[model samples]
Target: MSDLPIVGAALSLAQFIEMRDVMFGHDRDLELQDFHNPQTLDSDYTALVEQSKKALDGYGGRHGIHGPFWDLPLATWDPMIREVIHDRMFKALGVCEALGSTHMVVHSPYLEWDHRNIMHYPNAREGIFERFQTTMAPVVKRAEEVGTTLVLENIGDIDPHFRVELAASLGSSALQISVDTGHAHYAHGACGAPPVDYFIKAASDALQHVHLQDADGYADRHWALGEGTIRWQAVFRAIGQLTSNPRLIIEVYGDQSVERSMAFLQNTGLAQ
Candidate 1:
């Protein structure tokens, strides 16, 4: 065995029972998908939390949740909007605390437009960073208190180092970087961003989570492994160099995709 960590999956609450055996067999790090929607959080998730606890009774593997990202950008400038963002994040964190999840995935606020305009508007980048810092300061503090690491994932990011730099500037252990392979591949093919491997290298030790999905490099396909053009060998090679032991979750679309992805990786000797 290579000794590198085996890959995991992002499973919804409904899928837990059906996939419980595979998840428990590998001791997979799971990214719970139920709490990402703002509506779900706004309504009573008490039942959901209780249900999750019951379903995951003896799961000893790492657990995390995909935090709310729908219209909840971290770099909002308006104070009132920032408050909403803060409230949403805090609510998500509460779920983490309840479920004993050690990680939460938050989307990056950087846009491809910002990268092209940074030189023209020199202060814009710092403004975005400042807005993010202002918005996340308290959330980050609460995350540390709850023992959950908030991983900032690349969405429309063109510059690979921006999130890494933002996490570095925060100077908090609660904040770290996350890479979504499909998104990176889309950025590379469609927007001229560096390939997925560079994203990993730039994150390096700051990397704490990954959404592993193959893509055509033209769109965020979220395809099963070996079904798209992403260079899997190169991606895992970069992962092998990381000392962070980041959670690798196969974040594809279907229920069976995780198994298919894992089989591809295992057969190819990329991970097991």
Candidate 2:
């Protein structure tokens, strides 16, 4: 209702079409894993792309995709393992190009536990950042070649500063920061990181994407907005003040009510 390019997360093509009007008119955060089976790549995902294009014909809002990142650590020390991630990422990009998606979200590999493992070493933070950048270098280059911004999302990040620093260090226009509100809240309490608002401010300059979900401090509930403990008003205000316009996607559980979440945002004046 705010007409600010809000998106709904549809894990599959069927789910996307189920909210076709809401998506085409507004925007859609398409999740690739829903349609393409990662375990088997023998089948082409082109059909899914065709379906998506058909569903989003004449769409006015920008489109985004959440690339596959599970078990694929971009910053892993092993070169062979990193190659697997790079290959999978490129496959996702192929889908991105087919769907004309402008942005793709990739999970960060900097978990608090891993950071602690290097705490005693010299320049530990810098070293970890370097590994992440190194692993993502090829992905960033591919993104630039295809005219898409690789939005690095915070998942297991210990500090927001390091996350921001990584984006700045890339120095490529193809890279940007993506904040996951639920992850931020969970990390703040579980991993001893700064508050969620602090994470927003830290990454404001480079923030171009967001997975806007609500979660309790205890777990990543993926609850509908206003159903979790997050203070929606403050989060919206912080985002509103950013110089760049970020793509806000409503990512909730399969059974969660997106309509109720949208209504809450409208009724509270957080969104128009």
Candidate 3:
């Protein structure tokens, strides 16, 4: 396995340059996105990609794109959303080519924000599954065209088992899984389920990507290493047994927490 499967975290190109100059010293490797602007994504992205390319050359680390989340989860069931999401992803892929990122991380969308909409889709549960089959098909097409692998992450209520099975069933080898340990942990807590069982049950064959992080005992606090009650020994044992070492994206949401978390990962030596 690629030792630790590319130790990294989420970043935007602007942030990449800052991290490059100050953090990496050589001023290099990282991939990030700008989620705030709806109008300037194109020009903004173009500049970011150029800066990221320069940074990667200096940093001596690999770059990988984590597409934006918090608002535009890709699984949103709107047809118009397809264009907006695609545009964002197109810019991201442009970064991929410039920096030679290993792959792109895409979060699965959440259930409808409106309670009424959820009850109205009739087969929305089924439609939700099919929605990916339709909308995601283009995402896959785009990834191939852009020469990057697209990894779909498991989010709230979107069953992890279902995510892996769907990827396998679709039979698109390029499309793979980004197993979010935190999401799985939270999903289990929300559903009154077991965390270990949830992960162990995932098809090992379908796992190609993964996100590893520890959370505070009762909440998804995104704690630094050894502080969370995630049963790291057990988690590492389970992950180590797998045939392939999936990309381990250590995501610490904002600038404030990234350093401590990165230290924790190194100290824990789970991915090492």
Q: Per-residue lDDT tens digits of candidate 2, residues 121-163?
A: 7877777778888888888999988888888889977688777
> Per-residue lDDT for 9 in model 2?
60
Model 3, runs deviating above 4 Å: 1-6, 12-43, 58-60, 73-76, 110-125, 200-203, 217-219, 253-259, 262-269
Candidate 3, pairs of clashing residues: 11-32, 12-32, 20-27, 28-55
Q: Find the candidate with the highest lDDT and give its number.
A: 1
Local accuracy of candidate 3 as per-residue lDDT tens digits, 119-153: 67677656666766766777677777777777777
TM-score of 3: 0.77
Local error of candidate 1 at 240, Å? Answer: 0.5
Candidate 3: deviation at residue 141, Å? 0.7
Q: Who is ahead in TM-score, 1 or 2? A: 1
By TM-score, who's the top model here? 1
lDDT of 2 at 264: 74
Residue 15, candidate 1: alpha-carbon lDDT: 84
In candidate 2, which residue pairs get closer than 3 Å at backbone N, Cα or C atoms, i.e. clash? Answer: none
Task: Put down candidate 1 lDDT per residue, 117-211, tens digits, no spaces.
Answer: 88898689889889889999999999999999999999999999988998878899999999999999999999999999999999999999999
Error of 3 at 230 (Å): 1.3
Local error of candidate 1 at 46, Å?
A: 0.4
